[model samples]
Target: MTMSAHGRPLRGLADLRTLTGRSDTQIPAHKAYLRISFLELEKARRMQEIRTANDRFAVVNARFREIDAEIADILASLNGTAPRAHALEAPHRSAVGLRPVKRQFQISY
Candidate 1:
């Protein structure tokens, strides 16, 4: 027997009809099974999408790190110093030893 993603035996509408013999009592059960199967399929698709998005994010992050290294090399050359490769090894730190600064303004009444 073939199993569905929801762990139920795979059955077509015709198979369900033939098995249930159009009995009213069994109709609801079949409907419930179909609904659950649909929900499980949708959840699996969404989980795959999330996994793809995470992979893309990781690739973009790696490229950004490469760009940071290139910038550091350029800056070091400009400053007449050898690039300090160790300085940029910290994952949380960027090419420059500075964090983004936020400014606040005061409003006058």
Candidate 2:
């Protein structure tokens, strides 16, 4: 192998001949071919990864939106139920079990 100037791979003369059992004549042509193919493969892999991430984001976003709408509708129903409170009437914290029905939601009379 050639004595490299720095602590890099012996990417020259005798190294190439030993690596593939071919001579220096073949090294340039072989490296050029590998560079072209590797570039194309790298581009294809990146595009595939981007597509998979987008698909996952779409699914998660749809589920989030659905849950938000459900919560909004439930709160709206609670707001629509009353304009006052009494011993026989209450707010939804009791209805939804946050507070106890037996105790009443508030000291409404």
Candidate 3:
């Protein structure tokens, strides 16, 4: 391969042919065409990857919103019942086996 003074491979078509050892004159044209097609394929692959990532992000974001709404509903229910829960008294129990058992519920804010 022909190298420039800076030690980089030469960019000329003659240099390309010499590096590849191709006696055929059409190698440069064919290589250029194939390179363009390969670049197009790479571009498509990158776009698909981006699309997949975006779809996953959207799904995860939706799930988070759903969980947040569920949490809000649970909090609202707890707050709503807090006052009524405190006003309710424990139920009286009948004797079982020998002695009566009383059940108590602890309420904490």
Candidate 4:
């Protein structure tokens, strides 16, 4: 069931007949193959979609961590001797802080 890069498309039994030249004898096999190939191709497409989404998420997570670290360093440098309340307003706040997060974890709504 190998396909050429620019091979003829078998849109249906008639199209398959034109491409293979001996369509009558192989009609049953061709029909079965069409069904199986369509299903298999669909499954593979879905798997690829999932892999792409996973890669995107990984990129997002890495970016988020990078931004978080950069902001933490900036905060530590700017307010080393400031009062706790002033520093609390920074993004890299204490463990219980509620600073607004950066757009490093964004998706289009």
* Cα lDDT listed for each candidate: 0.82, 0.81, 0.83, 0.82
User: After superposing candidate 3, which stretches have Cα over 4 Å from the reference?
Assistant: 1-27, 80-109
Task: Report the number of clashing residue pairs per model.
Answer: 0, 0, 0, 0
Clashing pairs in 3: none
Give each model a TM-score: 0.48, 0.47, 0.50, 0.46
Q: What pairs collide in candidate 2?
A: none
Write down the RMSD of candidate 2 (Cα, Å): 17.2
| Model 3: per-residue Cα lDDT over 14-67, one tens digit each | 544344554775668879999999999999999999999999999999999999
Q: Against the true structure, whose lDDT is highest?
A: 3
Better-scoring candidate (lDDT), 1 or 4: 1
Looking at model 3, report the run of 10 residues with the lowest lDDT sum: 13-22
Q: Could you tell me the TM-score of candidate 2?
A: 0.47
Per-residue lDDT tens digits for candidate 2, residues 1-109, read 6766896865556554344554565558878999999999999999999999999999999999999999999988898775576576554453554654586457756
Question: Which residues of candidate 2, in runs, are more than 4 Å off?
Answer: 1-27, 80-109
The model with the greater TM-score, 2 or 3, is 3
lDDT of 4 at 22: 50
> Pairing residues by index, what is the TM-score of model 3?
0.50
Against the true structure, what is every candidate's RMSD?
22.9, 17.2, 18.1, 23.8
lDDT tens digits, residues 1-109, model 1?
6677899776776664454444465558878999999999999999999999999999999999999999988887789665556654546745687756687667889
